[model samples]
Target chain A: MIWPFITRSLGIATILLLAAIGELLDERAGVLNVGIEGLMLFGGAAGFLAALKWGLLAGFIVGTIVGGAFGLLHAVLSITLKVNQVVSGMGIWLFAMGFVTYWADRYSGPLPMGMVSPSIHGLSPMFFIALAILFAIWFILSRTHLGLKIRSVGEDPSTAEVSGVNVVKIRYLCTTIGGLLGGLAGAFLTLTYLACWSHLPTMGLGWVALALVQFSIWRPPILLAGALLFGFIWQFAISPETIYAGIPAPLPVLRMLPFAVTIIFLTVISSERFRKKWALAKPAALGQPYIKE
Target chain B: MIGLRFPKLKCERIVILTGADAVKISALSVVISFMLFGAFVAFEGTDPLVAYEHIFSFAFDPKLGLPITLHRGFFLVFNTLAFIIPMAAGIWNIGMEGQFYLGTIGAFAVAYSFPDLNQAILIPLMLISGAIFGAAYGALAGFLKGKMNVNEVVVTIMLNNIAFWLVYLLTVGGPWAGIAESTSKPLPKNACAPMVWNTPFTSIFVIVVAILVYFFLKKTTIGYQIRTLGSNPIVAKHVGISAPKISVIVMAIGGAIAGLSGYHMWAGDPAFLMIPRPEAYKAIGDLTYWGIILGLICLLNPLTSVPASIFIGSIIVGTTVLVRRLRMPFGLDVLFLGIISLVFAAFQFFHQYRIRRVKVVIGK
Candidate 1:
């Protein structure tokens, strides 16, 4: 029984895990892409539309491309134009939300029959893909020179520039990759997990993924843990009886648990003592835009 | 081939814009954004001109339009202030939506608890309690950000979800469950804000608050300190300013303003409290989002936010007209707003740096 519960949690957590890993990479390059939520939404709509018209493979490809495009837009706005990252990110989110919503309303009608996924050895292929990506990201960040350059750019772009790294190009590349992962995560939601396109299907998972980045302190492995924890909390909220004999509180209150836990964890990690303790994990210049002056 | 020498071209010096040039560029950006939006509307099969006409006619119809527009604009004033005040201190209080709902809950708690109070007494009590509740909620996020160094954006977003659920638990199936599943009983008549000869409670209150905020920001010592802190925190610290305390104070004030908007939303218009429908939730979310955009457009100036609020309010009213009359899809206003703000953000870059073309002289 516990095994099934854990498996279910992992299945649900794939979306968060993938998006959080993407954000981890993005933040490691010192570009905090707050528009991940919007990018994911755009990907969901794009993937769903393409899946309806063509096939699931097309859905994934189109979703990723759309997400990458938005990521490029964010890069242009934040990196090239030097807009305030927060405003531009939020603007991207609004644009994605509005545009996707408008198009989805006109296009998406109902889920076609038999669109659900077939389980692979009692687990989802998407979950395995997420795990593979997580391992790949961890390996890249920990073992590669390119990863070192990305980290250097995040930590101190001036030093990196003096060291002859192209800070702008690295940032753009990382942001686009982050967006691709975010798009893939959204595709997973539509093509595998929910198996149907719904308005804002990613919901606030993109945000939860963002918080998980902070919780993980930019480490990919720790992000996997944070995503699973949030996922289990959500599952527990929705299906409390599966674990316990009776319900604890009202469903609404139960649903608040995941968000409340995120706050508590964020507060704990944000403390000066903890930050000092984990100094290496925290990116020194996470959200600041790098201008070659 | 030997006679193919090119004429010498003079290069224009690329100088950063200042003062009037910056303003002109910003105005141009706004116009460009509108033109793009007009094109988008035209693509949707409605003549952009016709859409604009309907929007203006609906928003300016004296008998119906004037009151509704003012009513909507009044709430925006408070919401926009909720964003700009904290923003002036360089903090993003995106949790205004949560604070608004919490304020409604606070006002309703007071009004529901005291059923027979005098109108004069109950009104002030509700407003004060509402503001205090909102302040407390806002201060929670501020404290986390200031002391714990938490990312206020993430915290505020989480708090938004938490606040919605709390409201849902209270109004849906918990202690304050209404006659209907998602609504509470109407506030007592005495608790409702009294109207002045055809004007709303918010119209008067928003102006008063706007004036107070303007003076407080422009003429007060703390306000000056806040402005200094926002521009340069390192310098501010050298000058003995407490960043944490200021953050908490600014957020609290912002929360108070948003809380007042909640009170107005509840008692001023629909005159009852309900868990907003999903569509209404989208509208409220857009309201705060646009409030932030408007605040930025006004360069975080409170006095300017008043007119900005009215302009945004007119847009909101216009979108509603578009939906009702032209059968356009929902959330077009937010899409337009998103594009406009993006254009302006790009323009901010141009305002700072100019691009110039230089001719290369051969054999120099």
Candidate 2:
């Protein structure tokens, strides 16, 4: 029982990790893409449909591209036109949530036969992909010139520009990457985990990832740990019918755990004392639109 | 072959926009949003014009859709007011959805316990209790944001999820479980909201509230502070007022307004007087978001939201035609909201900046 739970938790962590890393990159670049939730929804809905028409690989690719395209739109809005980032994010969220939820219902067909996640010893291959991404992100943010560019742009676009960083390009780059990963994470829900189409299948997991970013204080390694723990939560706890049969658990009550914990975590993080103690640097210019005037 | 080439266009920041300029930008946004949605429908192999016609006619047909549309306006008006109030103060009450849920439970608690009370006392009691419950919840988030500098958006979202699940727990197999699966029995008739001329009396109350809010925001000192806070937080902070206090007030008030919508759903709407089934639970929040869209589209002006809410109500009524007749897909209402808002956000840029035709010489 323990082994099965751990493996399944890992699978859940994979989805969270991808989106978290994407968001981390985005925030690090000073573009607070609050629309991560919607991006994931768009990815999941479009990816599921694509997977049905073509294959699993196609689903992942389409999901990634779909996210990238929206990311591009966001970059254009937030970076180029300098539209308010939060509103742009909300617009994207509304559109994707609306469009995806609509079409998911229209095309509520059965999953393709035997479309399970290829696992070795009951552990998903996708978990390893997410781990690799986590490692790559850590390396990029710490060691590479592109990483320096992203952090500098996020910190102060004016300064980055003065120092010849091409702030707009870096922000655009990171935003797109974040959006692509967000979409990919959504695709993972339909293609790998549920292996079928469902309405709003992300079920606040996108928001869970947003919370994870804060909980991790924008660190890839801490985010990975948090994702694994939360993965063992609702998806693991209330999800299984037989495991908690003796406890007479009210499923809806249990479903509140993650969100409640998210609020509690946010409150704790916002406490001045805790922040001064363990806080890694949040991007100073986050949620601010860069103006070169 | 002779080719026609258009001059290059570019956007430059403008110092300020006049009223006419803002109106032009808004008008263009409406056109573009429709064109985009039309393109979407056309992609789905349907004539976009037909869909619009169906939506329009189905929305206004007196016998079938008009009454429901007007009834829906009751909730939208409150929802819009709830959204615009805090938003004008530069606080986002994303918990409108959750607050509405808490409002339902609050009203249910009052009505269930005082079932035999006379109509006058019980009705006001239920409505007041619902508002109080919603206010308490909204204030919690506002207090956290004001005191700690925590982001209200994320906090409200968490609260929304928790509130929804809490309601779900209560309705399904909890103490409130009355006679059916996933729902409760109807409240006593005395507790039901009173109607006048085939409309909930609260509809009149909402209009009065809107006018009062308009005056409060425009003419009152605290309202001045709220508007200042929304426009320039730095300048507002420099003023001697407490940010935390204002945040709490706006959110609590917004929550109170949002809470009334819960009463509207519970005892006001003839169709859904009972606790909603678990399946239809989250769908209720869809109304709150639609109101949010109206609030944003109208630039959070209280008076403007009145007509905007009515217009959106018709569109929402039209969504049924889209799904049932056109087989267009579910959530067309949301898609419409999304596209309009997205296009509007893009066009809102023109309010601050003007596009110019620039001559370009390649290969200098």
lDDT of each: 0.80, 0.83
List per-model TM-scores for chain B: 0.89, 0.92
Task: Record all residue pairs in model 1 with backbone atoms less than 3 Å apart, i.e. clashing.
Answer: none
Query: Which one is best on DockQ?
Result: 2
lDDT of 1 at B353: 62
Lowest summed lDDT window (length 10), candidate 2 chain B: B1-10
Output the lDDT of residue B253, model 2.
88
Which candidate's lDDT is highest? Answer: 2
lDDT, residue B102, model 2: 88
> Proportion of native contacts in model 2?
0.75
Q: Mark the regions of model 2 whose C-alpha exceeds 4 Å error after superposition.
A: A240-245, A277-280, B1-10, B358-364
Give per-residue CA lDDT, model 1, range B183-290, as digits (tens). Answer: 656567676666774555767888888889888888999999888888889999999998899889998999898888877876776534444544464356556666
Q: Which candidate is the best by TM-score?
A: 2
